[model samples]
Target: MALCEAEKTFVLHGVEENFRIDGREREDYRPMELETNIVSHAFGSARLRLANTDVLVAVKIEVDVPYPERPREGKLEFFVDCSANATPDFEGRGGEDLAVEISNSLAGAYRSPEVFDLTKLCILKGRKCWKIFVDILLLECGGNLYDAVSIAVKAALWDTRIPLVKSVTVDGNNIDMEVSEELHDCQKLDVTGAPIMVTVCKIGEQCIVDPSAAEELCSVGALVISVSRNKFSTILQTGSGSLHPQTLLECLQTGHKVAQRLHDALIETLVDIKPSENSVGFLR
Candidate 1:
C-alpha cells in the first residue's frame, strides 16, 4: 500500500516522537503468537503471527549423500513460498523475486557452522547424511518479513525430531543401516544457536524495530541483522536509501540489542510449549 505525502509525514513524525501509529515505542515489537507441531506430516512445523504478518514453516528430512568437500556435515536448504492471498503483488509468479531473496538470506544466515551445526545430522563419514529442507510459506505480509520468517524457522527446527539410527553395517562395497522403529526413539535438534533476525528501519533520524507497512514506506533504508549466540551472523542493508556512517553504526547497535531480546523471548516461549497442546490455526 502506497502512502500519500501526508501519511508519510505522519509516520515520520511518529518515529521522531518515539510513538508509532500502532501505539508501540521505537524499540518495541508488535504482539506475536507462535505455535508448534502444526503440520502433522512434517518432521517439525511452526506458525508465527506478528501483528498482521503471518508465516508458517515446516522441516522435512531425507537421507542423502553428503557433499564431497564437507563429508562430515549435512545439508540445510531453505525454500519460501508466498501465497497469492497474502497480497496482490504475490499473485502467480509475481512473488518469486521476494521468495528467492528471503530464502537466500536464510541460507546465508545458517551457513556458519557456529550458527547451525550440521555435523550432528551426519550418519556416516563421507556417505549417508540427513538433508534438512526448511519450507517457509508466507500467509500475510504487513512488514518485517525477514524477522518473522527467521523466528518461525527457528521454532520449526527446534520442534524437529530426527529418527534414531540403530546400526550401520558395511560388507564389501555394500552398506546397510537400521533405524529404530519406535516412534519415541528420536533425537531432537539443538536450535539454541539458531540465528534470530531483526529488521531496523531508519525513519526521520530514528531507528525502529518491527516497522509496519506504512512505516516502512516512510523509512529511508533498513538493516536486517541476524544474531546467533549473541553475535552477528549476517548483516544485510535493504532499500535504496543510503545512511551516514554514524547512523549505520547506530542501526547495527539497535538491531543487535533487539535481536538479543527477541531471541531470549523466543527460547522461553518454545520451552513452555507442550507437544500435546492444541494449535491455534489461521483463524486466530
Candidate 2:
C-alpha cells in the first residue's frame, strides 16, 4: 500500500475526525461478505471478504495417533498459502514470511485449551484421534489480513461436521471403528470460544479498529489482539513504531471492546447463513 504525503495527511485528518475515507467510524469495520461450504470436496470450507481482502479457509480431517506428550488431545495444524493471484509480490516464495507469521499467530491463538478443546477430537485414549488441518488461502490483499483470516477460520470450523463413530471394536492390539453411513448423522464442532482478532492501528494518538490500505501506510504503530470468550488469547505489537505504556494500555482496552463486538456480529451473521442450493466460489 503506497500513498503520497498528501494522501497520508488526508487519511490522518479523516481518522482524527472519526470518519474514514469510506465513511466508517474509527472502530468500525469495512463491509464484509462471508459464505460457508464453498468447497464441496472439503470437510468444511468458508470464504470471507473484508472489503477487498479475500481469504478462503478449508478444514480437512483424518484419523491419526495423538502426540505422546498430550496423549488425550488431538492434533490441530494451520497452513497458510498466499497465492500469487493476490499480488505479484507473492508470485514465487515472496509471501513466505507473511504466511509464516500469520500461521504462527493463529497457532498461538488456538493453543489454549480454554479457547479450543482438542480432547473432543480424540476418538480413543491415545491410539486414534482426529487430526484437523486448517488450510488458509489468501486471494487478495486489501488490508487487515490477520482479522479476515481469523474470521474465516472460525467460520470454517463452525461449519465442519465430524463423522460419528458408530462402533469401535478392539481385537487384541488391532482396533476397528465403524463410522456412520448416514450423512446427516454427523457432529458439529463447538466454536463458541473461538478467538476473534482485531487490529488496532494508532494514527496520531488515536486508535482505529480496521484500517484501509492507505490508512495502514500512515500508521506508526499497531496492535493485534485476539479475544476468546471475553478474554485475550494473544496480543502482539506489529509495525516498527514504539508506544508508551499508557498508550499500550489504551490500545489493549480498545482491542478488547472491539473484539467482543466483532465476535457478537460474527455469531449473528453465522446464524443468518442459510444453506444455499447453489455454491458461489468467486463468481459473486
Candidate 3:
C-alpha cells in the first residue's frame, strides 16, 4: 500500500539513478553495532543492532548422553523467542509464529554436518556429550530481521568457550570424566564456516540490501539467502509476492556479494576483539 503505481515508478526511477528512496546505494549495508558477553548466565552472549532491528543471542551448554547412532556426536539446538519490546502485538504468544519460522530457518541452515561439527563436541561415546542450546531473543523489529539475527548468533557463537576435558575414564558401566578446573582452560568454536544471511529486497527491477522498514514496505517482495564463504547455504523467499526466474537469480547474486562482505567484516571484527575489553550492550 505504500507504493502505488505512480510511487512504484518513482522508486524504480531512483534505483535506476543509483539513488534509492532512502538515499542509499543499491549495495550499501546499514550500520551495525555488535557486543558480546552481555549475559552473565550463559556461556556466551552477543547483541547486534542493524539500523533499527535489534537481536540478542545466548549460548548454554548441558550434559547428556550421546545418541546411539551417533554416539560420538553431541547436540546443538536453536530456540528463538520474540520479546514484547519488539512490538506491542508480541506481548505473549503473538510473536510465536514468526519466532518459530525464524528458528526453523536457522535450524535448517545449520542442519548439515558440514555447517557445524557436532562430532567435535562429543566428550565420551554413548556415555556423555555436550548439548548446546542457542537462544535468540528479538528485541526490536525495524527491518532485515533475518540478517540481524544471523549476525548476532554468529558473534555469540564466536564468543562461546567450552571447558576443556582433561581425561575420560570408563570402567564397568561407570564412567568418570576429568574436567579442567582452571577457568582459562577452554577452547573456542571454529566459526569460520558459519554462514551469514543477506536479505535482498526486490523493487520494480532491482534489488537492495538491508532495506529499512519503510523501504521494506515499499518492496514487492524479498529473498533471504544464507551464504558461508563462497558456498550457498540456504535460500528462502519471504513476503507475499512472486519473483521472476531471472530476477530471482539476480537477487541471489546480490545476496551472495553482500553476504561475502558481511562474513569478512564479522571475522575481522571478531579477530580484532581484545580479550580484556568489556562490551557495551545497548548502552550506546
Clashes of 2: 0
Please give the ranking of all candidate structures by TM-score, highest first, separated by commas. 1, 2, 3
Give a tens-digit lDDT track for model 2, residues 1-284.
57889998989999999888898888888878888988989989999988899999999999999998898998899999999989777988999999999999999999999999999999988799999999999999988999999999999998999999988898989989999989889999989899999999999879998887788889899999999999999998889999888889999999999888878888877776767632222212
Model 3 C-alpha RMSD vs. true structure (Å) is 2.8
Q: Rank the candidates by lDDT, best first.
A: 1, 2, 3
Clash tally, candidates in order = 0, 0, 0
- Compute each candidate's TM-score over C-alphas: 0.97, 0.95, 0.92
Q: Pick the candidate with the highest lDDT.
A: 1
Pairs that collide in candidate 1 are none
- Writing each residue's lDDT as its tens digit, candidate 3 over 183-265 gives 88999987888879999998767789887776677778899998875888888898999999899999999999888888888
For candidate 1, write residues 1-284 as lDDT tens digits. 99889999998888899888988899999888888998989999999999899999999999999999999999999999999999898998999999999999999999999999999999999999999999999999999999999999999999999999999998876779999999889999989999999999999989999999898888899999999998989889999999899998999899999988888888877887775773543212
Give residue 130's error in model 3 in angstroms.
1.0
lDDT of 2 at 282: 24
TM-score of 1: 0.97
Model 3 residue 92 lDDT? 72
Better of 1 and 2 by TM-score: 1
Q: What is the C-alpha RMSD of each candidate to the true structure, in Å?
A: 2.1, 2.5, 2.8
